[model samples]
Target chain A: DAGVTQSPTHLIKTRGQQVTLRCSPKSGHDTVSWYQQALGQGPQFIFQYYEEEERQRGNFPDRFSGHQFPNYSSELNVNALLLGDSALYLCASSLDRLAAYNEQFFGPGTRLTVL
Target chain B: AQSVTQLDSQVPVFEEAPVELRCNYSSSVSVYLFWYVQYPNQGLQLLLKYLSGSTLVESINGFEAEFNKSQTSFHLRKPSVHISDTAEYFCAVHETSGSRLTFGEGTQLTVNP
Candidate 1:
């Protein structure tokens, strides 16, 4: 089965601009979560989407938002981006809703560069 | 809130040598632990996980992690490494009630042949 897939493998945006990254969940998965991985650091959870609504969010600011479509695809939008917003944005899909036991399948991720 | 800490930022070793990567976590509630490996320009791949049962969990690639509740640590080790094993290793923890994961800073393993 095809695993999670993300669009626009790379993106470049200027400060004060907004960008949207897309992701298609793995086959048979419903929940989608977004993460931000800065250089030399592990990924940090941005937020999770279940049932088309954002269920949980990390310590990220309000500028970071996401949406889960009915087809289980997701889009992460970052508004008014700053230079620090440059990082690798990853999307992961899981079959479970809240259980931590469900393993997540990740996409190759979209590398965002804020210039 | 949960958080993970990987003590080593970089580990270099010769091929076929053993290696250990340390990881520690802090959580107020019960949590599940996981180790993921990321090769260059690739997504994170599940190495192994510790939910319950045995404290030690092994992966097919000869890597294993032992969960220590008292110490709040889950350190990963491999008996023998290969050049292909070089990657960034991440330690993550997730609360049973939440689907989110808290990850460590990651340890870069460089296995030279």
Candidate 2:
């Protein structure tokens, strides 16, 4: 089975610009979540998408938004990026969005560099 | 809200030596704990998880962790380490009523020969 896959393995964006990172969830998975891992830090949950709705969200600002397509793929968009926006963006897939017991599979992650 | 703290930012060990990485969490509700490993330039991978039934969980690579409910800790340990075992280790918690995982700052394990 194919694991979760993310596009634009790496991206470079300037301040005030917006960027979109894509993700295809693992095979047979239904839910997609986004996370941001800054240098020397662990990942922080951005938001989760289930049934094409934002099921749950972390303490991130409004500039960080995401969408889950009908096919279970996802896109994380960051608008008016700042230098601190530079980090590794990860996408994780699970069997169900609200199921606690379901394990999550992660993609290789897209490294975003805000210049 | 839930959060995790990995006590060690970096741990260096010789090959074949034992090592322990400490983790602590804070939550108002019962949580399912997890440890994820991330190699250089890679996404986090599940090491093992503790949901219920067993206070201790083991991975295929000789890594094990014991969940202490009273202490709110899930510390990862390995009896013997190898070079390939070097990676970034993250401790995370998922509240039973929540969908997102709250993660720690991560501990970098460097196993040297």
Q: Which lDDT tens digits does candidate 1 get at residues B1-113?
A: 78899999999999999999999999999999999999999999999999999999999989999999999999999999999999999999989877888899999999998
For model 1 chain A, give the 10-residue run with minimal summed lDDT: A96-105
TM-score of 1: 0.98
Per-residue CA lDDT of model 1 for A77-111, tens digit only, reads: 99999999999999999997445567889999999
lDDT to native, each model? 0.94, 0.94
lDDT of 1 at A67: 89
Residue A109, candidate 1: how far off, in angstroms? 0.3
TM-score, every prediction: 0.98, 0.98
Clashes, model 2: 0
**CA displacement after TM-score superposition, residue A80 of candidate 1 (Å):** 1.0
**What is the TM-score of candidate 2?**
0.98
